[model samples]
Target: MTRSTVDKALQDDPFGNQAEVKYKKLGCGFAGLQGIYYNGTICFHRRKVIYGMPPNCTTLVKPRRTKGSRSPSWEELQVKLGNLKELVESARSIISGDMLAVPIVDLSSRIEVAKEVSACSYEARTSWGREIGWVYGSMSEDILTGQRIHAAGWKSAALNTNPPAFLGSAPTGGPTSLTQYKRWATGLFEILMSRNNPILLSICKRLQFRQCLAYLVLDVWPLRAPFELCYSLLGPYRLLANHSFLPKLAPGGTTKGCSGSSHPPPGSSHSSPCYLKTVGLSETVFEVTRKDKSSCDGNGSTDEADKGRFTFDSSPVFIPPAALAILKIVAIAVGAWRVVAGAVEDKRGGPGVGEFVCCSWLVLCFWPFVTGLVGRGSYGIPWSVKLKAGLLVAAFVNFCR
Candidate 1:
């Protein structure tokens, strides 16, 4: 591993005081661990770069044929490997990134900090917690350190350079990739949901506002699927129903009572009921077919479309776009009435450019939903269940709010 340039921020060069120190090495395979000392003082040295991570970091011993012991299974070893990559990258970041006071892992990036950055490190706990809580997740402890370090006036730096200071592999293939994503989303969400989340942490520990916002963005990931899927389902429903939930104009392309007819029929023997139609509309649509021509106007039956809706074996994601399209069609249907009104009289504010723009955004948000409709294996993932739960929770939260 290449030695990184040390930062000049450190005041103590105890290691540099060589005349007062001596070096000793126990017969061990771990490199750069040779014990160091001042005038026969006891202790050691270390490296600044990461080449790779050991598979079983929980134990320093490499998987070997040990007496009276069987080795880990293939699956167990894979899990270890998965964990190793995370550790390797995180260590690399600590060695490279500005977060020395508040290091973050992941994003496949590298950073650097001056070793002497400790000059501003007022907290005495930074050097004390090597193995105190290795098993339990006291990660908030680290977060707290970052908070104090920054609050105390220390600075950190990020470095982007070639020949990365450390190297690691992420999981590949659909199953692993998705599993990893879920794991990350879950962790962030859980943190956000807890008092340990950046918001509360910031309050308790003087965390910077900017850092808190960044933390919120990251921690909010797992909550997205449900809302997105809800929008996705709207598409097909709208297409099938031939209706839209959007608020309608009063009539004749107007918000007020600019009417022509009330929703009613002609005179009967007993009495006459009547209604008005204010908006006039007409539209043309083009659809593609594979072999033959579709010789019918949309005014007829929608048996084929209905059949596709009921029988299509697609993920739920496709629902939103279909719904959005249905909404647009309904809006156009109502607005088109203005054309009829225009023929007889002049109208102005009825479903103007604003309506089109609004509909356009609905269309835009619908695209991802359309893609989700056919999403492969999406139904089988646990994320689906979690998504539904998130939606319910959101609804309840909104109701309470």
Candidate 2:
């Protein structure tokens, strides 16, 4: 997605705001790589981490711990604000070059008081108040603001930089991740369903063809719900139920099945079945990582970044994963034992290798959930969390079945 923002927006509208404004103010919501992606830099890292990466436009939120407030010294603030001014100048030069005069407002600072001669600019030139002036209400507010700016003939770009200007924590663990996904999906759905949706923008000729097409993909992101539900549910069921709705072969019977096991080696085709995953590129992709550091690393910096860096959570929600994990373990163990028993005795028949292998993968994948069930749940889940887990498990079982 396009990293977003219009331009420096404040009473200082650095570049002369005509009675009508021209050009864009880039107000990315996060504090990120300062002067990192200015001018030629953004296009340079186009291939690897930059291109496929999501737009780093959101700047309103910082990655600070929300537990307390912090006030810094005036000397510290002065030094930082000086650096910010240089970056703002660099950001302005990126678009208009040296020919255009633009004022880069420091949203976090005002130059009202007297300061060192070298760092402070003229008192009259300073812009006070917020730098990111657009409506920053909730999820869709940023996108909507960017869309309005774009419609008004303003263009935006993401600056490429290292030591990002700002950073934030991502939702971790099963419970938190699921909660975040649901909220995001809901927000995305609401945006698509609204009159201000990209489709309407294109219909009204507010967006060009390419932009409209790009936004349409973002607009339809919520539709993945059903398909994701299907995969999450039916993927395991395929192994358990021992069937799939898809045909084994093409019209001429010449085509191999998706699993490559539709027709087995000559004589074995009559009775033996082939393994589905045995021929595919796959592995146990889901593993829950947990952090259990009891104390600080003794680093002088008590920054939240360090804390977040050292800690990552395991599965937090109960029910769905626990049920699935237990089911998978039981099924796979039983199936494997049966296969082993059959191998030891000529008279015995057992579960097919394909079924056993498929179920075994589910067992490995859901093992973390089993941990959540056994250990985490024992501590006593909150009544509120239990309610949510019940609803979540019902949803999971519905999809899988």
Candidate 3:
């Protein structure tokens, strides 16, 4: 479809704020389905599939049928199966090729939802003061009940509550005060964060890393409190904004509570900031700078040299204690596995067999190299080195023979 058509379709959908759509013609004649998330919204869309039947002139039966024919011909069944297979293949292609788009509107919706929830909670706290404790206590019960009903597809249950407060607190033996209500809210946040694993996994399955990363960077991280807690958990690379995180921020300035040094200082006249700092999984703080703009000399005067400077600092970004622990365990396990594998290979024979095994291993181990060379330009390695290694191995094997 043309871009205009796709854009129109997205605009019509409630969730299509920042949607991206991709089109592909399936090699097999199957109908297709595309899953899309518009504008950072939680709602998902599956595109409808359309299929064409064989021409009407095609005959289903032979001209001369036996008087007592008990069974249908296998050819008809085969044709039906073929059509079904084609549809399945089309769906698979659309999903596997990552052809779905996320519209901007949906993202805006999610932001609105989060903000509304925060606003509601703030207003409740401000008005009732100590009575907010009981309010939350009652709301928690209603929320849990609503969740149960919602899970069962009773849509009305979701609307039963005036403001739709979830089960978040319980009445205390003594009079519940604002302090107690705040504590309950804090506890509820923790529960949500802990339960967010399933949501994260769903995002990973959909390969929506950008959205998943954004949700974690914003909703998940901010709940930890003390503002610094979020950065400390993210580690050094925290300066570099995540793929998902950047889109959620207000267009120009640095994101609130984010650790990175803002590029071009806050009030510069340039259109956008040059860089953002973020911590990586490695705890290293890296400055992610935008590519320099190309300079053009209109009147043949020499263009000024681009002098943007970037520095990669050695300070470790903050990481959540849990994430750090997991990384350490994974690193230790991988190291141990490599040591064991190497020892086993060494004991099996000498370096000669090992070398041959390694060559075969390379083919399987680095399939990306072959695929990259085929799909892209080159593997980014010297051909001479590869050739020399091959020849050296061939010569050694010949000597052994």
Q: What is the C-alpha RMSD of each candidate to the true structure, in Å?
A: 24.9, 18.7, 27.6
Q: TM per model?
A: 0.31, 0.43, 0.17
| lDDT score, candidate 2 | 0.36
> Which candidate's TM-score is highest?
2
Question: What lDDT would each prediction earn against the true structure?
Answer: 0.32, 0.36, 0.26
In candidate 2, which residue ranges exceed 4 Å CA deviation?
Answer: 1-138, 163-165, 171-175, 244-318, 334-368, 376-401
lDDT (10s digit) by residue, model 1, range 146-169: 323333222332322354443322
The runs of at least 3 residues in candidate 1 whose Cα sits more than 4 Å from the true structure, single-residue gaps closed, are 1-155, 244-401
Candidate structures ordered by TM-score, highest first: 2, 1, 3
- Comparison by TM-score, 1 against 3, better one: 1
- Cα lDDT tens digits, model 3, 151-216, are 222212001133322322222111122122233233233323443332443343332343333233
Deviation (Å) of 389 in candidate 2: 7.2
